[model samples]
Target chain A: MTPSALLCQFRLIGLCRKWCSSRAFTCQAAVNQLRREQGATALAGRVDRFGGITVDLADVGLPKDISETAFADLLTDSLGRWKSEGKVAVWLRVPIAMSRCAGAAAARGFTFHHAQERHAVLSLWMGAGESKLPGFATHQIGVAGAVVDESNGKVLVVQDKNKTKNAWKFPGGLSDPGENIVTAVREVLEETGIRSEFRSLLSIRQQHNHPGAFGMSDIYVICRLRPLSYDIHFCTRECERCEWLSLAELARTADTTPITSRVARLLLHGLERGFESIDLAMEELPAVYSGMFYQLYHRQIPSS
Target chain B: MTPSALLCQFRLIGLCRKWCSSRAFTCQAAVNQLRREQGATALAGRVDRFGGITVDLADVGLPKDISETAFADLLTDSLGRWKSEGKVAVWLRVPIAMSRCAGAAAARGFTFHHAQERHAVLSLWMGAGESKLPGFATHQIGVAGAVVDESNGKVLVVQDKNKTKNAWKFPGGLSDPGENIVTAVREVLEETGIRSEFRSLLSIRQQHNHPGAFGMSDIYVICRLRPLSYDIHFCTRECERCEWLSLAELARTADTTPITSRVARLLLHGLERGFESIDLAMEELPAVYSGMFYQLYHRQIPSS
Candidate 1:
């Protein structure tokens, strides 16, 4: 029989086993004995650094025709062995082709970790107390550049073509994956066609359930940027208008976003009482992970 | 034949059709005719408010045994039609049972949008230019509370039992999904057994590629909190030590993380110059989404 036909037969058997839960143990034992006789590979897995067991079903050489009942039996037996071995967590990856097994895992208390192209990962904490697993990223970061020409006392701003309000705001966009705060410089260059260099992070706005972020929280960072070239050449596709407005006038204008007006006032304060008063200076520090580093932004400590 | 056996037959036919690209068109036409004769349900979808199409395969009533080739053909035909209809984006959700269709969709330029337990979502921009679809969340928010005792000029701090370095730091933890900065209050209470109320956001630290965050970026927010009760009943499992240390001493000490030390000085600055000199006060504003509100953190605007 073709593999697909065999799969059908196994599904039928699995359906029957589901209705006869009392006989499941005997059926599972028989299947296991048959598998041993056929020299079929046992479910394979590896131990993670955290003493957790990770099983990728696609790479485990599962029989294409294995029934859900048999798979569940194998999983239960494995969990019992792993628990005795003091495994802390179990990470299970179920390929799309063998997705029927996900239900079995879920019934055994597995919950989703994250999903990718060809598979879905489920996790369970087998250790004592609450699960210590860190969750998936749940916020999007948007970096905007407030390009100020100190010589002229003007700042570059734009009105997006797509937005209904068309309120003047800083030229900005979402930060790409693995991008740094310097992404604000690129966003400014793209939207207004002006080159700038990142100086210091000025302000951060944290909002939850952002409409544009597809129901995720948003972190908007405004950076103080020093303009390199002062010519205006904005992208017509993204912005309706772009200009260099007087910083003082922008701060008092009613025709801009609240954030823009607020940042304008902040820039005014920074200008009058030194940028150090408002700047969250970036400092690179070695991360806990050896040979790796991360950027830390905080108030600059005055040199003693 | 059972649905599973029919699925197998579909796979065999799809495999054959894949090898015969020249005859694939004719085969697809025949399949379409067969579908019409059998009165199979047409692919169902809805147009979102943004003029994008969303097709959930689980709810679309696809044939139980539809071949991959046929699914691909249908998707291609749909794309052409939707493009002519001026659809901006196409959101396709494929359930695990029909994940074989994912490859066919990907070949036509569909990329992963996000994934969930039962289905994975793929997206394509059918508009004039680049896809405007917002990306999935890519940063995790960690909120920490620095609880200050105004009477004694002391701050609450802790050293984690699990970390190699038992450095003094504010008691805090990861923000739960949809939780506000006020989560810091809860985390402080849980870790140090001190009840506190959130006063103002003090500082934000943005870091990328956090080791503990599964390769995602992290945003850490620190909030100033006032102590409600000052009894030290720390959770021994999570902390090695907890104490109320002098604010001035923590700022001058070398036995703490750089961030903690910097925040200590910031708090000291606040003590001397007033918190308005450093605080990012929270303001609740109506979000663009009707009936929704979001919290904005920025320098307080002085009442005119």
Candidate 2:
């Protein structure tokens, strides 16, 4: 036997011994029986909506000691059975522990679909000419806070240090995973040292093939925020210039990006009239999933 | 040697034989020399802004025949060198071919960060506190289209067959990867058989802990559309009811979702005034990346 297989057998024996300290012979017999059963059983999987099978290797409990050749044999058998059953697609999720088997699966025509922290999912279309499966998240969310000091009709803006043009824009960055719009306040503080609170979501810009987002689409959300602190301790590494500029001047400035200038004009209108004239207020409501909630941004409903 | 390792060596010998058919002795010598050089070379990597080293194993070119023990030894030496150099974090990217090395890296404190089609990225923090490395995309974008017939002051709506509440909502679904807002028009037609054209992006809702999105966040975008075909051949599998409801009644009725009611009120305001009063117009701008463009949606700038 290979060293890895021997190591795995030893580990299993150790586990069994711990479970049944008084009966060593019985424990060894049980381990042998379990190995036999494992070899005989087929890879467990569930049929998806499209008559496809999804096999999560973590749930399959791959034997740690199995050689690559052994894995290939098992996969070959599984594929043969699945083909006979007329499955259209096969999704195999391989955990890190069983990554050695990836090459075996790949050789059998499995291509990567997507991956997460714990595992990678590979797919194969059995019936079709080409796979019709949709790709995973292709857009990145960027949240920017337009920190407005309503008292003076001024809005906080910054120019990036790394840019050639250094055009003025709202302080923001890519939203962290699982972050809410309110997290824009933290980004504003980090970039401009201006403490702020999220007031309302103002605008959303959807763009395709954003270079900064690893060639993926980008969704830029601009939220109106009320400033809590008005200090200019800007981040030297991120921004070359930071200021609270007048709304009118910013609206007409050629030094700013088109979106920034457009937003500035919108803020000017809000300052002149009530914010209710343009604001898309956010409301938290229970999501379809029990115990989960979602924020809905829309025009404020007039209280009767 | 294991069967897999011997197979890998044979493959290399085969490749070398094809490259140099004239000299068998020279080809064997070159292969042996290459293997010796590979064993001595350290894994190559680059430093990030946070003083972290990122090693892409694809670039490292791990030998196909290398054993897990050899990988573990190489990782141990590299970790000791990095720790001595005062590196804060280590980002290791292992391609599918080299996934067998993942367990070796994980044994030395590495954990999964994110992964893509080609490879999986694992990270380890050697810093004083926790790792500041951000996570990958955590939000799914759902696009909905509200097809409005201006002549009749009516909007197309649907009540999902699967939903218990059967509340009226805009006809739409999850936006496909790399899809633009214009794709919402197609979703409207698929869910309800009314053809429509994209008009303007009305509102965006950002929510967290969405159940349908694999426990990730969700961003729901609502776009106003102009209907081309008035006939409603609603999808029986998706919707129980579909109709062109009067905008005024939709704004007042409790039969619809809160967002639908709120948007209906906004539409009413737009109908009374001009669409310019509420519409967030889209403008395509040249992105920072050359030859690429992005769409920016915001309140229309008055033409001077």
Candidate 3:
């Protein structure tokens, strides 16, 4: 069947599932449960399968009018509208006086299998409210890297000429244009000639404006690597030299320019963790958003 | 009223309206008649009351596939499980994948409203897929600009010490730290001594390693201005001289530079459009992303 026809059929089946799955009492009980979970934490937690923490916005002492569940609904509703057609959308709630828009979102049709009882109550704070530093436009491409062949808690490093003060650092660069970020991880292996496989992204450092003779050098995504082949040889002209050093001894080595304290700390932690996936969460999100989680889940708009 | 109670009330009112406004009809004939009266195109073209455009994915040659919609459901379900307090909801269907994502968007959700009706189909194409480029994290803090005085179809321009080797240009500079963008806009006004107000973002231009320049410079939301006052005063530090040139004379001016081509073209079109509100859509977006129209609306994961 044509792709369109298949979709139509699938939507039909999904509608049936939604219909069959719900009972009024169960939905109502679910709403009550959501109410009990309300708190002042922010709701900007990652929506991954593994449980992530939701901050209580009120905990931060921001506007505390909205219930956590209600705030969740607002965000969820916005997402529904934004990502429907591959289009990215974002919503800003500003004071009516400052903003030209006075009207609230129009009600779209939604099929509710279950009614969510809770709502968000946070009021829009005025005068330089929360910063959505990362707008919706930045596309996040997944990337992975590794630290290889550790002998006595030491991994690998390379000295480079281009960076500030010609410091020793991990041998990696950005993913090429149209290159899969994951694939780029492997390229590090090909260039360095040291057999290394993928590891989790250890930390992300955004250097808005790097301090040096230069202005802004851009942010770097640091990764942890594991060794696949031991003996190392420089296969590319990108770096000057390579070596593996223990964290304790590495600090004394000036091969790498003085890494940021944060980077240094992460490196130490990675050594302790011994290569594991690390979850990165925005620690700054307010908690009232957490209270709004329920509304985000169950509110449905009409199907076009 | 309690925040949850407010939401419950809104939902209740919506439910009553649904039941009272339309009688339930199960027959295919009734569905067909409704479709005919509304016309699929008309129905599809309805502007989302909340925000954004809604297009039937089926109408646009895209469909919701079984695997993708099911996956979408999984996301909602996953979000619900992670939050525990409230479910993550989204506006379903209102397919927007074929368009650019911008403006007011919340989340992406897909659902099938009826079993008998065609199941919505989602066609998943391979690869990283096209995504919108993120603007600067700093730029999102809002922009400030001036609306210059009525120039009678003539706008003020300055010959720059750097680029003036060829053309006339708007007088402005990078925003300083701790100052709001609007403050920067006002600063430009004081330095230039020309009254103006912000109109809209004109465009974002990033030229890497241009013929003469070494680094990238971002363009700003162009402001329109009234001649609060005018002076022939030259800021010897940056500008050589200020002049108000008519659009007709801009091309013939000996001092016009290569970059002036873009400025001229923009001015010509903007002037033709009566210079009402700057066409932010045209300015802020690349030509490639302009064609897309619809987006995903709202999605909900039933609290199971």
Which candidate number would show the highest DockQ if scored against the true structure? Answer: 2
Q: lDDT tens string, model 2, B1-304?
A: 6676555445544554444332334433543454467563446799987799999877765655454556777788788888889999998988766666776777788876666665677888999877766556667788899888889899998999866687888999888767777789999999998988888888777777665665567788899999899988999988999999999999989889877888898888888776667677777887766576767777664554
Worst ten-residue run, lDDT, model 3 chain B?
Answer: B293-302
Q: How far is B124's C-alpha from truth in model 2 (Å)?
A: 4.2
* Clashes (candidate 3): 138
**Which pairs of residues collide in model 1?**
none
For each candidate in turn, the TM-score is 0.79, 0.79, 0.24
Writing each residue's lDDT as its tens digit, candidate 3 over A155-184 gives 666666444565656666554323333343
Error (Å) of candidate 1 at residue B75 is 4.3
lDDT of 1 by residue, B1-304 (tens): 8776776656654543443332435555666875576454335688887899889877665653354568877787778777777888888887654555655677777766766555667788877777778788888889999998878789999999877777999999999778887799999989999999988888777677777676778888889999999899999988999999999999999989988998999888777667677777777777666466667776655554
- The TM-score obtained by model 3 is 0.24
Judging by DockQ, tell me the better candidate of 2 and 3.
2
Once fitted onto the true fold, the runs of candidate 1 whose alpha carbons sit more than 4 angstroms away are A1-42, A48-51, A57-77, A83-88, A94-109, A116-119, A125-132, B1-42, B48-52, B62-89, B94-111, B117-119, B125-132, B252-254, B272-274, B301-304
The lDDT leader among the candidates is 1
In terms of docking quality, model 1 is acceptable
Worst 10 residues of 2 chain B by lDDT: B19-28
What ranking emerges by lDDT with the best candidate at the front? 1, 2, 3
